[model samples]
Target chain A: MSEKQLHEDQFYITGLKENNTSVIQAIYKKFVPKVIQHIKNNNGSEAEAQDVVQEVLITIYQQATEKKLQLTCPFDAYFFLLCKRKWLNELKKSSQKEVTFLNENVSKDESLQEMVFQTETFSEKQALFDLMFQQLGEKCKEVLRLSFVTKSMEEVAVKLGVTYAYVRKKKSLCTGQLTQLIRESVHYQSLKNK
Target chain B: MQEEMYFAFEQYLGNEMNLEDRAAFEKKLLEDTYWKESFELYQQTHQFLKTKFSGETAAFKQNLKQIALENQSNKNSSKIVPMYSKWFAVAATVVLFCSIWFFMQSNEPKYVEYNQHEKAYFTARSEGVAILKEAQDAFNTKAYESAVGYFEQIPQANRNEEINLYYAIALLEVNKFEQAETLLQAIKSGNSVYKEKAIWYLGLSKLKQKDYSSCKQLLEVLPESADDYNKAQEILEKL
Candidate 1:
């Protein structure tokens, strides 16, 4: 796997990481036309296409940073899949009239399929974690938040008026508690099994 | 998980445990796959938090907004201003109708009428004034060959936009089209007083070269504030 050559689309990912406006603009100018046409052909308005494109782009950026996303396929195919998935999800949530894009042919590219699967799982895992984090007790949330933000248990302890030992113990317990909450959740098991 | 075991896991992962304790933790991990999985999740969560909630998140969002702003700026080429007064709105509608009607009546535009170069004059002081004056007078008198020869004599280290502008125009006058186009492209890409003029002349150069499509494209994008925008647009509409 490591013998595989890096795709030229890596330039776009690097550009996104560095927030180069020209590269981002180039991505839109080059790759977005096909996505927009596809949306319009399926009865979506230009406004909806724009919003979908924007959301999909932001997701790519977020996943890139959070998961160190790699492009094993051409960026266009991966981006199209993401936008299509997001639009399909939207169609399901809203009672929007049926979109016919399900019949559209995607390339039989295994690497692309693997990447799409990883991205979808990563997205769900992120959403599940965020939701589960909110379900943590205030104390657990505070300790974990402070420890992560501060990067030092000593500082967190001082900020929260606790002993160094207490901070260390509390940080572990809070993280452990958070993990427990996640493991006990129904979504966590499905995620793990996936 | 027991508090002691969780604390041991934290200390082991955090690298705060003593070497003996670290060995003990490793021994426990080999025996207990559940702890290994738990540690893996803990490390992933740690990484996720670092990315999702770190200081760079704000910058990332800000950059996205900047890109969005840049994207929208292109789409903002045609903007509709709110005309609140009834008379003002009616007047605007009438003007729009008149322009559309006017455009429909016009014949195919040609570039020859708009391609004529205005005479150029330049000034300089100190050591450069002699050659600068010679070039300027030569250019003024339509001796393009001697104008280019004299202009090329000045040492070319500085980023003087005015000099570059004159030099480029001289180059164009003498049929040194490639050199002239290079200078015009530089000026167009730079922040300078001659930027718009460079664009106009670049278009004219292409027009002279009979590259009608690019000439029309460039002329169509000249902003209203540019010196020759109206003429460019006129030539553009005709083309």
Candidate 2:
């Protein structure tokens, strides 16, 4: 498909928010073979490739929902880079061994690299947010953590033994508090100016 | 003005303001310089607080220090140390609580379930093709029951018409001629790539059910170019 056609396809696929299983399955069908080929070329098995592909797709879904991910690169190259990096990470984590192969054509795309880097940076920021969530008072921490982690106001309310309105209030306050903290922190100030 | 602004700020920040109150507060933020300045200050302070308290390492260090001091004080008491170490105890309790919460949450239908055959079955059709490697595996292993089970789980919501054709073949293999016939009929009416096979199977199902006339009617609809067209023609002759 032309790059424009692929972009349109991805837009169509990502627009499907209600019944995502079939859209996700379609994306999986189109991209998974290339991912599998990339992984197998780098000393990974088909099964491992399948697991990595699924993880990459799930990450894309979560990012799209929670962070409102937008596509500026072709979906094929972007997906390929993500799966490749994920497999490399798996290899590093499992055996402490490095496997190198000729760079795939997808990796040569500068925009694809930038997209992958942006996703990785967002993931790191989220991880830091999770880490900082532990510093609040137990009640505040529990409420805020459940709000983001569960993505459900009613469930967070039940868990925190509060009314739903109270939970919502607490979440907004907690998030505002967190943002204020980040703004004041020396690290955050430096990072922001950077 | 500052106090009034603070009250409105608290309400707005807490999401406690009604719609009118919210609109008034936002209007003030947009138009009133004094309210805007205080709101900005409040925003700055809130951001500061969040940064200071978000890291788990800080929490872990405090917890560890408290545990060490408690252990030291109890050294002379001759009491048994807790078998569940303090950190492990906390971790275990958290896990248990989360498990209960998740179990309760799971009362809603799960979209995915993992089983070996189900995985293979999905993988076979994951490409949107009618390849029967999974079905053939099930058949070869005499996992007919599981074969039928897997076949039945294909989501009707999005499957192309080819799936119905495969499902009918699976049903026929499992000796579900009645169900197979219904599926084959649906496929025949649709613009399925498997329309020819559906026709052949419809005839076979009717033959199995001893409905010669209906079988003959279906067999006549098979295209001459179909692989099974001659077989269908022969079956019609027999009927």
Candidate 3:
């Protein structure tokens, strides 16, 4: 992966990272119509199309900004595949009648399929991590959020009215508890092995 | 692994570990592959939580949502836009019909006499081109054709809104109405510095073209903050 050259369409990823409005507008204008049409023809409305497209863009934005997600395929194929998969998943959740799928070309492209799999996996892991983090107790939650966000054990300790040493130990313990909780979850096991 | 071992990982990461303990930890990591994997997972989780909960996340999400909304509106736009532009886009069309009806009845305060073109003294920031000054001067002096000539020579490569706006106005004056309208439409539809001006000028261009229905629709969308808002309102009232 390191040796693989980034596709020119990496501009879309960089554009998303920089929060360039023009690029965002271009994505919606250029690539979103087929996603909308696919959704609308298959048990969806204009409103649902809006939500799916927004969610897909947000996922890409999150991965791009947080994980430094790099695109090695054409953005159109990668983005369309993500939207298509997400909308199909949504349909399954709602238990709607399955409409005939569009874009067989998506699965035919090996590079697009690989890139799409990476983003899907990243999105799933991100969601699972957020869910597992929330299950932590209130004290653990505050300690973890504060430690990670503030990044200063001394400052966190001061804010929490505790000794710096206590903060360090509690910080590690809270995250340790989180790890233990994730390890215990069946969902985590499936995700881990996958 | 014991819970206390996690603190050792944290301490090592925090650069608080003494040399001997650090060396021991490294040896242990190499010796125990499972523990190495767990440590890496913990490290990944730690970094993920840090960024996911950061203060910037909410604002970034909101910005993305707004951009999506604007794009969605642009996509389905025919007579109406969705989201915030909806009310105005529809209202503009409604106002168009009303103004057309009013135009047929009252011959008072004519649209043509109402607008004595304001001498645009504003020197818009454009790429440093010598002819831009002459264009501005020619436009101010009402030498519309020559202004059109100079403004047309300006590089359109950058999609510069200010240049487009001035060029469009010159296009309108030279009776190249269709070209002017297209340029104004592009500028008005996108997020540009000249958006409000583009809308107002589009209305004026339509009015000059004797298409009152189109004129009223465009005029109604000229926000109150626009320079021509009062004039637009007066024209609407008279129509």
Candidate 4:
């Protein structure tokens, strides 16, 4: 990743991570109009287009925060492709009838495809982790939540009325259990296959 | 045993293991794919939890929702801008060039086009001031040189800003730029109805002097509330 040249538009990712208002507004102004038009062309409404754009941005923010997502292609192409794929998937999910999918000339750039894939994978894994987390026992869920949400293990212990050593040990065990549950899921298996 | 392994994973990640134990852990991971994958997943789970609980993520989502709402509402209000077809684009270009052509035909702002100053009215203000009457008549008749001469003869005590404004215009018309600008500057600084007029004339004085850059600079400062603002814009575009 270091060997590949980072595009100058990487500032979009940085702006997103920083949650800068003007940058987000610029993204909406410059790139979102194209995405909205595409979705409108593909049997989607303006409200649905807004949802797809917001979801794509949230996924990008998550990936950047967790995995340091680097952009090699222009942000416009990458962002539009992500929104398009998301809207298509939404169409596929909601339409029980035969829905005609318009296959415009999506970008053929290898790097753009790879970047979109990475973000999608990250989003799927996040969803899987959230689902698996909810399925954990109440004790484990409480321990994990307090462990992460608090500033430190000591704070977790103080909040839960447990000893510091117990909180520290419970944090590891709960995370481990969560990881095992994720790996055993069909979703994780399918993601790995992709 | 599984619980103890997770504890070890935590210690390894936190760098709490001694050198010998750390080396042994690394060797086992190198030799065992199961242990290696488990360790990787454990680390990833830790990162996911960190990001999930982060305040920054929540704040980012809140900001994104706000911005998206604002953008959507603004878009709806404006309605979609029609995608111009090829012919539409060509038509727009033609209109644009036509306006530009007409604009270019209206050449550089001439002093005469804007120099139709209102007729000086001093007949009532100072009934017995003979020289004020002379100044007003000379200015009204466009005898600006003699207007300047008559204005100079008026006593300083009787010479009010209104009279001074007329004197400055006479100076400007007769090409006495330094004295004209000085008097206009004083009235421009004073609080009077003619303040804005003084500013407009100052711009015109610069224009008549063929000082295009300075003229543009002065005209650009004319506020929209001024009566001459639209005229100033026309000169500005040509300049």
- In model 1, state the lDDT of residue A67: 67
RMSD in angstroms, candidate 3? 17.8
Which has the higher lDDT value, candidate number 2 or candidate number 3?
Answer: 3
List candidate 4 stretches off by more than 4 Å.
A104-106, B79-239
- The full ranking of all candidates by DockQ, starting with the best, is 4, 3, 1, 2
> Which regions of candidate 1 are displaced past 4 Å?
A1-3, A40-51, A66-68, B79-239
Better of 1 and 4 by TM-score: 4
TM-scores of chain B alone in all candidate structures, in the order given: 0.51, 0.42, 0.50, 0.55
What CAPRI-style quality would you assign to candidate 1?
A: acceptable
A1-194 in candidate 2: lDDT tens per residue? 12422344457237332324445455555666678778888888766876776556545644554444667678877877888888887787888556685353445666667668767665544445555555556877666556545546788788778898777667656655655555455655434432
Measured with DockQ on alpha carbons, how good is candidate 2?
A: 0.02
Task: Please report the candidate that would top DockQ against the real structure.
Answer: 4
DockQ-wise, the better of 3 and 4 is: 4
**CA error at residue A101 for candidate 2, angstroms:** 3.1
| DockQ of every predicted complex | 0.28, 0.02, 0.37, 0.63
Poorly placed runs, candidate 3 (over 4 Å): A65-68, A102-106, B18-21, B75-77, B81-239
Candidate 1 lDDT over residue span B1-239, tens digit each: 46876787688778898889889888878888888888777766666656666666667667766766566556554343344366678999999999997778555454456646666655744357778888878888878899889878888774277778878887886779999999889999999988999999988888778787988888877889999988888777667
With a 3 Å backbone cut-off (N, CA, C), the pairs that clash in candidate 4 are none
lDDT for residue A81 in candidate 4, whole number 0-100: 86
Local error of candidate 4 at residue B225 (angstroms): 34
Q: Indicate which candidate wins on TM-score.
A: 4
Question: Mind giving the per-residue lDDT tens digits that candidate 3 earns over B4-33?
Answer: 788987888788999999999999899999
Worst 10 residues of 1 chain A by lDDT: A96-105
**TM-scores of all predicted structures:** 0.58, 0.41, 0.60, 0.61
TM-score of chain A for each candidate?
A: 0.81, 0.65, 0.86, 0.91
